[model samples]
Target: MVLLSLVASHSDIDLETVAKISADASQVASVVLASASPVAGAITLATCNRYEIYCEVPQSEDVPAARSEVITQIAASTGLSEETISTALISKTETDVIEHLFSVGAGLDSAVIGEREIAGQVRRALNEAQASGTATGSLVRLFQAASRTAKDVGSRTTLGSRGLSVVSVALELATDLSNDADWSTKDIVIFGTGAYAGATMALLRERGAHNVSVYSASGRADAFVASRGGTALDESTLEAALSHADIIIGCSGSDHRLMSSDITSLDRAERPLVAIDLALTHDFDPELGALAGVDLITLESVRMAAPEEQAQSLREARSIVLDAAETFATEQRERAADAAIVALRRHTQQVLESEVEKVRAQHGCTAAAEEVEFAMRRMMRQLLHVPTVRARELAAQGRAGEYIEALETLYGLAVDAPVAPSMKNAAGCPVTGTQSAAAHHDAPMQSPALRQVG
Candidate 1:
């Protein structure tokens, strides 16, 4: 199996930098169908932070050539100039490929500091990529390990702590810079009280913001707000309430901008309105930031203000991924051994049965010594079944090497004309079935990923 990756840094890259030409699934599928892109399983992962394409291609020629074809397909779908898209991404190799994906899953590589939403984004991206016939073998294993590593990383971190949200960080940033420090004097309006919004509110309350008012689309949420000792306002009334609101925090998932229409929207604000937009897709409009009286801070504005660490968790996570990949390599080798033995048993048995039949044909006498000899050989073969069947089972599960090694030593089965079998491995040799390590090595290494951590 072959593995590769496409990565784009935030500087020159646009999410559309990797966005497929097909806005929807059916359109992309049509393109794949037309290209005769020998992809058996495909997956397209697109997000604001990064865009990636992975696929499982059938045996044709080289994997490197196949990699080039996949990137070309992605470029065609996106309508980006070939050079532009190609520049945005770089291929990952060896442990680099596996670890990078794990970082993404772990949310260490998100725009927002420790944003948990990235996990879901990665999952959705993998699902789409798989649908495109771009996922199989190593790519499939890579994603599964990435996802597992991500889960472990998240569980271990203080990521889920209330103080870890972008919203909390935004409020703190705003509070530090803003001269109007009185929580009771400043009217703060919170729009959309989802997890992000909720976390923001908790932070605001911790800052002793007594005059906090929360608004959500659901009317029933007012009681939930009331229980928290904050005034509940209908989200429908947010436009009118903006005049009284000194600071506005928005965490809505709407594609359309909620506030600001030209300079007039901010002209109504009595003070410098601090509007914080904290969505991956940017819930607020960019034009609003240009408004005279509006002090709009969005994901783009703070896109530069990421978690201060160069992702130490990411660095540590890479180490974990490397270790996992190494463990996997060992398992793959052991599996190859099992496969060699199981094939030898099947091949030897076939020759023995055929040769025995031929010898029986030559002896016309029914009760000849040759017939008795044939019967004993047949019984020996039958007796060997006990060990052969066990060895095959172990080989199928990736442990056939020990059994095969023992049998070879016991029976001394040898091919006079010796050549290294065509088994795929670190050496890049292709081995034939039964003669090679297909059942043994491939089977043991066949699992999507070995769970090294919870």
Candidate 2:
């Protein structure tokens, strides 16, 4: 199987393009299912800075054609021109896809390097795909491994030691000029009741900023405040909240400006109000920065101020990710080899049992016939044990594909035959099978391994 991906992230694509090219997770599933043929399963990861689609396809399929089909589907779903979609995406397959996923899960590819949130995002994406019945088999395993790799990076290295996040950076900037005593006296007004708002509030509470209020552009402010323990403010009280707030956070996900001319009109002491806009689209107007007692920080500024990882830490993080990817690939190869090993063992057993039965019938079930049967069984086991062990060793050494191919050529194993749900992993690798163990003598065997072994 080929692991194929189409990625649009902050690394290459601009924010506007990423937003335009992005598809809903369910929409991505629909597009994968709409492919012509040979598509196994798919998973979509759509976050603030990225929109990625990971799919499993037959290795023999024409890669260029499959990619074009995927691109066409994305264009149709996103209402973007095919050229635009093609330009916005970076395609990866096979080992490259594995490496990219590991890096992403570890936050190496994020705008804020080594951020802790991406690991959860990757896991959540996988869970969502599984829940929607979009991810299966090898695809599931690939994502699960990626999540594990991220965890390893976090726990085993200092890559994630800073716990850097956009919200965290914003908070740092807000408190950079204030002392611990100032935090106790500070009043913070958060404008947005969404995920970013919640994160900001949590960070503020963690930093001992207790006098915080919530302002909603929509009507859900009261409920949000109720859940998170903050006072909700409406339009009538918004000005008052702003007047009292020393720090204002805007993450309302609105295209329109939340800070109007009223911000300038509000009565205030000489204290400067720091406004941090976390929205992808500007929630605060540029003019707000020009106010006499206001300092406005945009998303771009926050990203710039994000903490950088040391070179050694970055190298360690990448090393960890690559190692995890290699381990996952190795395990997959071993599992592939296991299917063939099981098939070969089963074939040998069936042959021994058949020959023993023939001998018994010919010899009229004598004690000598039973001795011959036992001898033949022992001989077969001895003859097959070395080859089975060698096959598994080859798999662990990254030569499993060649071994599998040789096994199929030598024994005519039908490795492409449909397997039961329980037998297949997310990548379409067969885990276990025994139903057709004794049926190999038939022509054109349809078992997952050994189409024919005579």
Candidate 3:
């Protein structure tokens, strides 16, 4: 199966479009699973700012046709027109796909470059695909390599050092706004109780904000607040909290706006209301920022204000990502070469065994015959060593497909190379060369614009 990728990320698309596409990750996964032919398997990774479908298609299928089908499915799920999706999507094949995955895992593709959350997201996508039995061996290996690369980058570089993330950036803005006043005296109200909410709560506490209230749009406020040591407010009290609060943090994960025209119009405190909306869908009405006593910081603004790494550091991190991707591709090629080497060895051993048995039958099973059998085995082993090593070397050198074809032609061995299969399918019958060999080099992917929220 050949690797293909379809991507819609914040870098190339607007937030509105991205939100629509990412509304349901599961539905996107379903579309990918159903539309592709002989889908060796597929993984759909949907996050706040990106929605990508990675598919493994049998080489026999029309690649362009399959890509069209997947784009059609995405349009169906996201209510987007096919023309729009076709125009907006970023497509990658073969090694380009590998490089993109590695970059994403390393957080080099994220809007907040070096953000650590994408590594977990990539892992979760792989896990979910595996659970559904859609992930094949190639994908498993690719994603594992990605995860390892990300961790390596984190350990080897300062990419993840210094509190970095949308949350941290928002908090920095909050602290800046609260500079004139003591953080301990401010009444902070946070919307939503998901991971973002928890993270915000923790950071707020670290800044000495003792008076905290949480509103759960999903009705988990009680549990969320209890765990985080904050008072849980119900919908009825939302307006009151909004009016009196010194600070408002939005991460409700709700599609509906938290601050409507009526809520923001209410009069009161002299201290300006500092609103930080970290959610992708935008938790508050953007118009609320126009009010006289409110300072609103949003994902876009935070992303704009995000710190940029020194050029040298960025170059180093990118070098790490590229190196990891090359290593993974080489490993996969080596693995693909293994099948032929194994088959050749097995055929040689069988021939030697048959010859040894014939000699024993002809001469009597004597000590001399045994010695002859041992000699024959040793000679065969020595004869096969050079070719076996060369085949592996060729595979590592990106000539795997050529060597495999040569082995098949020379030995008259019908080679069926296996695609990445779960352990259950590891011993699947040999496949012939009808399918095209894996590509040695992928097209260079265009450098996506500065990382966006995805």
Candidate 4:
């Protein structure tokens, strides 16, 4: 079966709606399982930013047609325009499949640069696919190799060192407040445990601000309490702390301002209050800014702040990813060649026997008949030897996807070679794969963006 991958990322698609569309994990898994012909393996990797379907299918079925069916399901689930999904769906043939999977495992295709989270996500996804018994033989091996490479790359390098995702211009603007103004010995309290909050916390720490407390209405108190370095102060406690804090980082989801002085009973203090609201809605009470010694920073004002420059170290990390992508593509081509050569040898053997038998029948059973057959076999092997060698050698080259495709075509071996089954099929259905969803319970993914809340 050939590996097919569809990429849907960076388009102007509704992200939350896409998540909702992909929420029916069972249906998505079933479709993926059903799509792969001869049941090699199937997996659907999705997040708010991207959704992809990978499958092993026989060369016969129309690939684009199968992918379109998946697109319909995705659109139906998410309520997105079907045309958009169709337009965005991407497909790769032969070694491109392996290259894509490796790139994904390596986080080259991730929304966040050098995102460490994608590795665990991919591992869990492969584990599910394998458990469903849909993932068998070569598919299982390919995925394992990809996962191993990811682990190796991550462990060896400082690839995701920042861990801090550089988001929209808003958070960077908030960062400027620390540099533009000096708030030493200031109580910089974080309200809401969102991604923005975490960023503010890290920045606050960088600025030598002590008493950095994090408060959230929806956030877990236990997590906050154990946040050790970060105080897990609740909204009630947050308001009380606000009076004494020099910088108040607001990250709650309340429709109304939770920063009102009346709520906190802020006694007019000599210290200046810099309240940075990072929530979608205004979290801090507007009146709090009206109080003496208070400066309220809203999202609009945050957006107005200058953008942060890319760090040199992070840029270097990006180079590492690019190098890894090239290396992965090279490895894929070599393996594809190897598979093609195996297919070629089988086809050649069939042709050789047929031609030799025809010659023997036409010439009649004479001593010369056996000699002619031997010479014919030798000649055929010699004629085909160079092509076979070239096919394998070409496969080992770096970034040789196009070459691999050409070699497969030239050798008359279809790129989508059916993999032999190592284990018997558990499902009775005519499957390219088994129709099973990820049956195991994995911990729900916490929004990396949520870590930004303050």
Candidate 5:
């Protein structure tokens, strides 16, 4: 199956639009799979600043239709107009999809570059897809490769040396905004009990923040705090926690936004309160930033404030991602010739079996007959090995069509060649011709951009 990715991220759109689309990410895969589209499988990766759907379709030609189907499903699920959704997303197929996902998993595309949290998010996305039975083998391999690429980048480069992340940057901004720069002196309250919340908690502890309270709208706070070392707040105690909190971090992205009025109504201390909203769909309303005695830190603000990594480190990381993408694409291309190779081997095996059966019939399974059969089998293997190797070589060079044609012409072996996903340039021209691999390797990598769908 061909890989297609529909991406809406902080680079191409505002965070508000990203949040709106991400709100229904959990359901997008199921909706797409249940539809009449040619999509064989799908995996959704929804984060604070990005929402991506990776799909597996039957053929390269089905990509446009599959893209349309996914966009329609996303629009339907997210209550967005098709045109709006299409405008927000960039369509990626073949190697572009591979490179994009690798870059993302390695945090090259994050608002806070080189953040490690996205790697875990990428792994979890595949796991979630597998659990839902919506991830096909091709998509699974793609994601696994992404994970490996992420690890390679992390280990080989100093890109993440500071352990930077959205949460870490927000906390850094919070430290700057707080009256006391020391995290231990600040009374912190974290909203939501998911992965982001857990990450925030760990970072806070690293910064020596001990006076922390956890609150979850879905009653998960108790269990979350039990394992994570925080005081759990129920609905009745939430307002009091808010009032007492000197620093409030939101990771929940819950439907119930903490409005300015919610905090204003509370008899909060007149001291400075640094409110960090790390959620994509904000847990705190934007108006909260305007409140007296409060300073807001958001994903957008964090993006602006995030420190740039060393230029050499960034280049090293990107090179790793590019190399990984090329290797993955080459392997996938080689796999495209598998059907042809299998057909050739099957044809050879049939001939060998027929000749061996004649030997057995003529010699009544004698030792001489066995010797003849063994020699014939060895000769057949020796003959097939070169063609098998050539098939893979031809496929990787984007000449699988030629290999399949040769098989058909020589042996009357009408093998159904597997369709490899075709690469396209930003202008929508196919790049999978015989020179595609060489051209792609020589060309500089470009950022994924909007490819508007009709």
Candidate 6:
């Protein structure tokens, strides 16, 4: 199957549009798989600033239909118009799909370059797709390679060594806006207990901020704070906590927004409060930013404020991603020759069996006949070796169809369609080895060809 990717990210669309698409992204994969005729499988990756769908289609010609179907499904799920959805997404195919996903997984495409959180987000997207049974073998391989590439980028370069992320960038903005420019003395209140919330808490601590309070509308604050070294706030105490806070960071991603009135009604705090909204689905109202004595920082602000990664480090990381994408593309091309290889092997086996049966009938299963059978089998394997190697070579060069046609013309053989491998490594990586024993059993032997008389 061919790969197709539809991407809507901060680069092409506004963050508000991204957040709107991301709101229902969790269900898009299942919806597309159930309704899209040309889509064999799908995986959705929705982060704060991006919403992307990776699809597997039956053939390259089916791409437009698959893209339309995916957009229709996304519109149906997100209440967006087909025109708007179509306008927002950029479609990527072939090697571009591989390169895009690898760049995304490596955090090269993040608003905060070299952000460590995106790698985990990419991994979780694949896991979610697999759990929903919407992931195909090709997609599994694609994502696994992405994860490996991310790891390589992380290990080989200094891009991600400073622990930079969306949360950290927001905090940096908050520190700058603070009167003291010090985190250790600020009374920080963080909303939500999700991954971003946890990240916020850790970064706050790293800056020596001790008086941290966590509030979760879902009542998870107590457990969240217990392990993370923060005090939990219940509904009755939330207003009191807000009154004392010097900075507020929102990452809850809950629908229950904290309106401007909520902040205005709090008890007196003469000092300025920097409110950082990190959630895609904002926790604080936009009007809160306009309120007196409150300075608001949002994801957009963080995006604009994010520092550029070191040049040499970024170059090194990008090189890693490029190498990984090329390797993945080569492996995919080699797999395309599997059907022709299998067909040729089966044809040779049939001829050998027919000749061996004739020898058995004449020699009555004697050692001489056995030796003759061995010699013939070895000779056939030897004759098939070069053609088998050539099939793979042509496939890698995107010419597998020529090899298949040659097989049909020379031997009257029809190659069976290759099936996606069902086997996975224990670590969930796709098994890229020769798919079956029959295709690889005689791979090692070599010899000269003898004319076949029918």
What TM-score quantifies how close candidate 6 is to the native fold? 0.90
Which residue ranges in model 4 land beyond 4 Å of their true spot?
Answer: 11-27, 34-49, 52-55, 60-62, 87-164, 167-171, 177-221, 224-229, 233-327, 333-391, 394-416, 420-454
lDDT of 3 at 188: 83
Model 6's number of clashes is 1
- Which consecutive 10 residues in model 5 have the weakest lDDT in total? 445-454
**1 versus 4: better lDDT goes to:** 4
lDDT of 1 by residue, 1-454 (tens): 3344556634346543333322232234324433544443445565544655554443325456656665576667656666765666676654465566666667656666556666766676666544433334455566777677667666665453343445655776676557655665778887665656666677777777877777766554587586566777774666666777778877754444564572264336355677887654555666666766667776555566655544565566556656666655444334444444444555566667777676677875567847676776788678767775676566446455456556557655431211112223344332222323234445443222111111
Q: Would you estimate the TM-scores of all the predictions?
A: 0.58, 0.81, 0.85, 0.50, 0.91, 0.90
Q: Please identify which of the two predictions, 1 or 2, would achieve the higher TM-score against the true structure.
A: 2
- After superposition, the stretches of candidate 2 with alpha carbons farther than 4 Å from their true spots are 23-26, 34-37, 60-62, 176-181, 191-194, 215-223, 233-245, 252-272, 281-294, 363-370, 395-401, 412-414, 417-450
**Whole-model Cα lDDT of every candidate shown, in order:** 0.56, 0.76, 0.75, 0.57, 0.85, 0.84
Ordered list by TM-score, greatest first = 5, 6, 3, 2, 1, 4
Off by over 4 Å in 3: 60-62, 178-181, 265-271, 422-454
lDDT of 5 by residue, 426-448 (tens): 55433323334455358664322
Worst 10 residues of 4 by lDDT: 445-454
Clashes of 2: 13
Instruction: Please count the clashing residue pairs in each candidate, in the order shown.
Output: 27, 13, 4, 22, 0, 1
Candidates in descending lDDT order: 5, 6, 2, 3, 4, 1
RMSD in Å for all candidates: 11.2, 6.2, 9.2, 11.9, 9.8, 6.0
* lDDT (Cα, tens digit) per residue for candidate 4, span 293-360: 56677644533452332566345544554565466555655665655555555667778899888988
Winning candidate number (lDDT) = 5
- Per-residue CA lDDT of candidate 6, range 1-454, in tens? 6999999999888988888777776777666666625777788998878999998887889999999988888888789899988998999997999999999999999999999899998999988777666777799899999999999999999997888899888887877777575778888889999888988898888889999999999999999988999899989989898998899889987887989998888775666788999988899999988999899999999899999999999999999999999999989998888877876787688878999999999998899999999999899989999998999899889898898778777887766554433323354433223432333355454322223333
The digit string of per-residue lDDT tens for model 3 on 135-254 reads 666877888898999998888888867757768877787778767547888888898887678878988888788989988877888999777888899879877877788888888758
